[model samples]
Target: MVVAEIAEALDVRTWQLQEAKDQLSEVIETAQVRGPQMITRHGRPRAVLLSAEEYLAMTSDRPDFKEWLLGGPKANLALPESAFKATGEAKVEK
Candidate 1:
């Protein structure tokens, strides 16, 4: 795999698909030590290999939809009086 010299500055290494596949262990080790390792196919970026710790750190704090909705600032909306006045078109009652 051709290691991208430019990516070195970012502490990331780019590996060709075949090279990364052939040396999967090394690639994983590199990701663990150096941050993220980018995998490329035909010179285009296809994926990134990240250490488990890095992956967890990136995803662990994300809240689910319900939690996110509940955690947001409360809205203090005031509905118009007409909104509470139901039209007598429906028969359902509490």
Candidate 2:
């Protein structure tokens, strides 16, 4: 039994926190079959439950920060000497 109707424009189902807690299993099952289930507290969105496949699909193809930085095109632009001048009042000891 569907506890709530799907919000067609968003393609998601929303449930009040209490309602979701009361029907936790059903919510999880629906998340697995449907796309995502939104849980709201006091009529305000609080969380979303997604199937394992959906979560993996959403995250698996994305690169990590390090990988993203390494994959960017190389730049060979030159800067003026003043660009390297120290602007701090700290002294370096060797």
Candidate 1 structure quality by residue, lDDT tens digits, 1-94: 3446656666688899999999999999999998899998998778999999998999997999999999999987975555556653444355
lDDT of each: 0.84, 0.82
Candidate 2: residue pairs that collide: none
Tens-digit per-residue lDDT, 1-94, candidate 2: 2334435556888989999999999999999998799998877778899999999999998999999999999997865455556554344334
Q: Candidate 2, which segments miss by more than 4 Å at Cα?
A: 1-6, 79-94
| TM-score of each predicted structure versus truth | 0.71, 0.71
| Counted clashes in each candidate structure | 0, 0
Which ranges of candidate 1 are over 4 A from the true structure? Answer: 1-9, 79-94
Candidate No. with top lDDT: 1
Can you give the lDDT of residue 92 in candidate 1? 34
